[model samples]
Target: MTDETDQKDQAVEKEAEEKFPIGGCAGAHAEFRKGNFGTFVMRAQPVPNIVPPPPIAAKPLPPNDEIYAVCAKKEIGDRRGKSFPLMRRWDDGKLRPWDIFIARFGKQYFAYENACPHSGQRLDWEKNNFYEPNYMKVLMCGKHGAQFDVETGVCISGPCEGQRLTSILCFVDDDGDVCLTGINIDLDADVEPVKVVDPNSDEVLENNGFKLQSTKREFFK
Candidate 1:
């Protein structure tokens, strides 16, 4: 009877080992009994690592005396306008700030200094607000009710009638960038905040007057 009982106990032990294998639930419980509670606890699956994409780089600024891109062509729609702040180095080696606006009339684009011909004040009363409330046919000055022709910068009806806004030579480049050309300006110059003068200011007026006189002389000759 003792030999039969020993054989039965050995058979039960072998069955338990086969059912739970080594390092499985039954083996984990045995390790737990040996003061290793962590071995008996369930573990989560390993997670994979994820990497993010790189960022896009911005376009580099052009050098001085070259064509400097004012803004993208798509930014201004037909009959719409936008303003930009620029720095120009003068002949005297002084850097001055310039407020300029670009307006589109049909497929043509025109650019001018933001200063009004009547007064030296900027055309916009509010920031970037350069047009009339409901009428965009003309560029209106916000300080006083002054309207100017979109094609020609000539003041049509205002205090400074017959006076024109100082125009800058600009055209659309191959890259669809509205660029300023034939103008001597330093794009990298650090400009100081000084009052912007009108085109009729003493030295500027004299220079412009001389150019008009020269053109008249050449036209007749």
Candidate 2:
């Protein structure tokens, strides 16, 4: 009776294997005789992350000190009919030209690009000139007669109604010579000339005419 029961169980298992076959694990339910087969499983691992740090602070700059270079004598005053523009020297022993009217406003200096921002012409009427007869007050442009504040370089009148003169800032030295603390240089020393073409005639002119030929003269006694 026991042999007959064992034979019956073996026959049932053999029938199930024949019906299910291999690759039957793909189905949601794996058909099997009770506890006849074991299942194998694989799991993926979690990945780790990396983070970066913030940037460091920068160093501060040193204080500004007045720089100087010798220009023509004080008696030379404004170079009205002169060929070259006058300049204040720099700490590095370089020259920087004047954009202000030296005659009307005395020791107090102003520096600007010699070019008129409006028409791209030289600001001077003739040579180192940038003023009218009553030269004691304001600066005047030579091209279309634009006027500016002698102190602030602000345009008060003329073709350039709303435009202010381009200023290059500088301070005066102990010897009353002008000193350029800024990065700008004179038309004579460092910077290259500004080039432009005339809209009407197609003639090209160097806007930096302040660099016209002239001998350097010393003003300090």
Candidate 3:
């Protein structure tokens, strides 16, 4: 080959080497040359995983069980339930938050903690919405599809099968209203209902049957 032709070829080769380095065109990302574009394109990289935030823990209650409040005795029909968020006083005397749910199965009345034993998360998928569309017969966890017995709070199916939910003792007052009587919970102070938002829309949604004004809070099982 002629000397000028050889020099031109060598310069072109050096330019390609400098432009698209050995491993990649830009730094460490492995790149390949696009024949049509005549440019180096980066290889596909995996996206980093993101973990969801944990559920909010319930407030601790005092040592002795206290009669916090009285709830009305409403017929627990299909998709019927209620949530009562109360601040509990622990041994340290700091106030903590815990919620209770009252649901009905058949002719029996029952009250349970609003948390799922399997995931340590709340039971309702939406705000106080725990029914499975089968007349609210089974209480399903909103997170992992864990099913529970409405009357017993025992896990019937799902990851937490054979596990029992935290139960709270409720009494039927003489006026036929349900009274709150449970472990270490005292509901004598002002309590605010937690506003729930739809993860998809990011807008605040109605809390099923939970009402802010009424003394009776109603929701699905």
Tell me the tens digit of each residue's lDDT in model 3 across 1-221: 69999998788666656766564545323333333344443444567798889976644643465564456676445457667786667766666666878776654667888888986877766565666544567887766777888778899988889998888887677787777765775566666554443334532222233322212223322
Q: How much is 109 displaced in model 3, in angstroms?
A: 1.5
**Tens-digit lDDT track of model 1 for 1-221:** 99999998778656655644554666767767878654233434457687777865433233355778878888888877777767765655555566788888777888988899888767754445566546578887766667789878898887888998888888898898998875656667654443444434332112111311111111000
- In model 3, the clashing pairs are 59-96, 59-97, 79-220, 80-219, 80-220, 81-219
The candidates, ranked best first by lDDT, are 1, 3, 2
Off by over 4 Å in 3: 1-65, 75-79, 192-221
lDDT of 1 at 3: 98
- Cα displacement (angstroms), candidate 1, residue 170, comes to 1.3
Residues 1-221, candidate 2: write the lDDT tens digits.
89999998777656655545454443214433454453322223456576666764432222245343534336336523122244444555545443332332554556555666678666655445566535436666655667777667777877776687666555566676654454433434543222223333322222223222222222111
- TM-scores, all candidates, are 0.55, 0.44, 0.58
Worst 10 residues of 2 by lDDT: 212-221
In model 2, the runs with Cα more than 4 Å from the true position are 1-104, 134-136, 184-221
lDDT scores in order: 0.67, 0.49, 0.64
